[model samples]
Target: MTESRPHALFCFGTLLDPRVQTALFGRTVPTEAATLAGHATRPLAVAGDSVTAAGGRDVRPTLARKLGATVEGGVLRLSDRELAAADDHEIDDHVRRRVTLASGETAWAHLDARPLRAAARIVIVGDSIAYGRCDPEGGWAGQFATAHIAADEHAHRVFNLAVPGSTLADVGEQTPALLPPRHPDTIVVAAGINDSAVPLAASDTGIDGLRDITGPLDALLATARRHHARLVVLGPLWLDESCTGDFEGLRFTAARALELRAALRTWCAEHHVDHLDLWEPLRDRPELFVDGLHPGTEGHKELYRYLSAHHC
Candidate 1:
């Protein structure tokens, strides 16, 4: 008798850790450092606020100074049992779904979406929050990956191409590289937090940073529409006051974050994009923060639950 080929799981977060993988899979599984095409990864950070990480200023404090090189991690492959364990671990916010790998192969993974009769290919584009910043096991995006279900289980896939500190400007330059050749059914825009943090003086043409924001947002929406994808715009979440210490230049109060949220809400309305506001419920809950900007375990779970329930 021949042994069965193990089920493959492409893990990009805490599960990339060998020890963590063992804990979840009951044994160390095969893994690799493969990049998912149409996505780039970067170090997660808190925007609109700050927090202490490694005893340094938390929010973009290393701007003038070189903090270090790039953040790195491995992608894991697991057996069916391990995948099930991962699903259970992430059960609070995600439902397991299928995805297409860079090599044009299909695999099962978690996705964030409400229960729907039709499964739509979802493309999430943004910075760290969409990249699964703070939560080591999985960020809200990861939870969303684990939670979304499709009308036809085999027909849908979700792609997350979020980069930490990725501003709208960066997305404009990188969209062609990050978007799949075939368009997705739905596109989620989770930007602006970084744009709000960038210095107002960076642009060469004397355009304000706000223009920098709108420029890319406009292009991104155009791209989505060209592909016939439904667009969903997500507003920024509130920043924990305690986390504000690290971000030197872009100091914003919770009220300011809410103000940004309101502005984004208006933007989405004008553009006809479906809007989801993340700040409304988290305004008072500092505990939801892992280090003030990033959501803790509970925070990830809550975000997933909220979005899943409200997804149309």
Candidate 2:
């Protein structure tokens, strides 16, 4: 319905967890313990911790398709907003379907769906570009998460592991450590700017020059492929005025950014990972960048728009 209204929802998974219910629906509603017919339940491999049911057993439950079977759950009357929120909480792995309960009541139940589009662990690693330098809240990662939730209606976590002024080597070293606890299904790498900007002496393998991050880039991609099933690598963004004019010996320029972008595009191709070239789409949009280097709020929005059109 267009207007906010109350709707009945059947939860079979971790939605049975009141902590999860409160996180997704804002507040827990009065739920009636109920049962759905002709379905079984199993464990799902998403990021959420195993839920402890009322009987003191930990489980990660997913609805299994079966004939003449029954599954126990609770039904909650949620508002239109909360219903939408519940849908978003389910993410890509689960789809909402109308089903008849054991009590002969037709209610909406979330069922497991496809793999990638279902509930997943998405991680973003990079430098200031991914970090949302100037406008903290408007970072592309945040925008993607919001849009992803709105579109998927399932809870997928986007962990932003980007650091300002971080080189590809830094990301490589951090990736193995970062992936524990919650391994990523899709990992996006947005780096190369810091590698191109910093001085030669500051880098470990910049023996070739400031932008010579081949060693680190290789290390990072290797780590990504090792820990994740799907990978998306992103290139550096465009800068306004050449940082060379601002800082001596620093060769941060549009040309350099383009060069780095091309190199990254080639690398992603070689690795057979999804690649997004951030330079071309954003190069001409001077207003999107705050200072010549980092993106402003609108810049982040533009980045998100470009990502939505190309990758998301």
> Residues 53-119, candidate 1, lDDT per residue (tens digit)?
3336433211010112122234456555666787775423344544445554545444443322122
Over the stretch 1-312, how does candidate 2's per-residue lDDT look in tens digits? 366667889986666678888888777677789987656676765554322333354445677544345888899888888888888766455656555677877677776543223325678888877887788684877888776667645445678888876777778778778886665656678874766664434653354333456677677656654542345677677787643354444546666666677778777666544566777767767777766787888888887887766554
Task: Provide TM-scores for the models.
Answer: 0.57, 0.57
Scored by lDDT, the top model is 2
Where does candidate 2 have its weakest 10-residue lDDT segment?
Answer: 48-57
Clashes of each: 15, 11
Off by over 4 Å in 1: 1-119, 149-152, 198-208, 248-252
